[model samples]
Target: MKSIIKKIFLLLPLVLAWTACNDYPIDEDGLLITTRSECYVSSFELLGTDQRSVIVDVATVDTVAQEIHAEVNFGTDLHALWPQFTLVTDAKLEPKVTGFVDFSDLDNPRQWTVVSGNRKVRKTYTVYLTVQEP
Candidate 1:
């Protein structure tokens, strides 16, 4: 009985070590690309002169990285008006942050400008943005 008890204790650690490393491979330096369309479009307004504010919520996912960066993809009309839009990600502010697109002038408007005429308008639309590991 004493010999049996001593052998059992010796085998316990070996059994645990073998079981701990099942058939799982470790992957730490893997680059993952994820897409999300769940971001909410809250507001869009024309800025003073040649800029527009597009407010949109940042996507939240359980597997997303802690410090995420995004790139904006505007639609044909909106994109034409302002080809470049600024992106900001802040938790405290609604819609996270405002994207700035330039649409300051009409007659003298740059080559790519949406026709809004003289009316100050605010339109809301879900923008397709790209978030990737950078």
Candidate 2:
């Protein structure tokens, strides 16, 4: 019985080590790594200075064209507005959108790039905002 107990203890580390070895990869976020190449903005939102939505209706996201269009109420301040974007799973955005950004210039749209989780695909998106007529 003592010999059996010693053998069990001796093999326990090996068993644990074997179980620790994994064939699958994990990302920094602890998510299982995948080879998905999909990269696009699924949704877009703009917030006013008061932290309220400035969009007149749902923002339009054109994946094929890689463009986003949003209409804000007339007189809405675009000089300091916050943008929020929802992207495909495991995708990342460049120049990560964090705080307020200037969208007052209608001619020059803002551009952001989306990179796939596997780093296999990249898409640059242009964001356009227009003010509704009072």
Task: Give the 10-residue window scoring lowest on summed lDDT in candidate 2.
Answer: 22-31
On residues 16-108, what C-alpha lDDT tens digit does candidate 2 reach at each position?
877766545665656555688999999999998788999999899999999999998888998999999999998888878778999988899
TM-score of decoy 2: 0.77
lDDT of 1 by residue, 1-134 (tens): 99999999999999888775543322232212122223322222222224543323443222122122223323313332323322222101122234544432322322211111111222233333342223
Q: The CA-based lDDT of model 1 is what?
A: 0.31
Q: Which stretches in model 1 have alpha-carbon errors above 4 Å?
A: 23-25, 28-134
What are the runs in model 2 whose C-alpha is more than 4 Å off? 1-33
Global lDDT of model 2? 0.89
Indicate the TM-score of model 1: 0.25
- TM-score against truth, every candidate: 0.25, 0.77
- Go through the candidates in order and give the clash count of each: 3, 0
Clashing pairs in 2: none
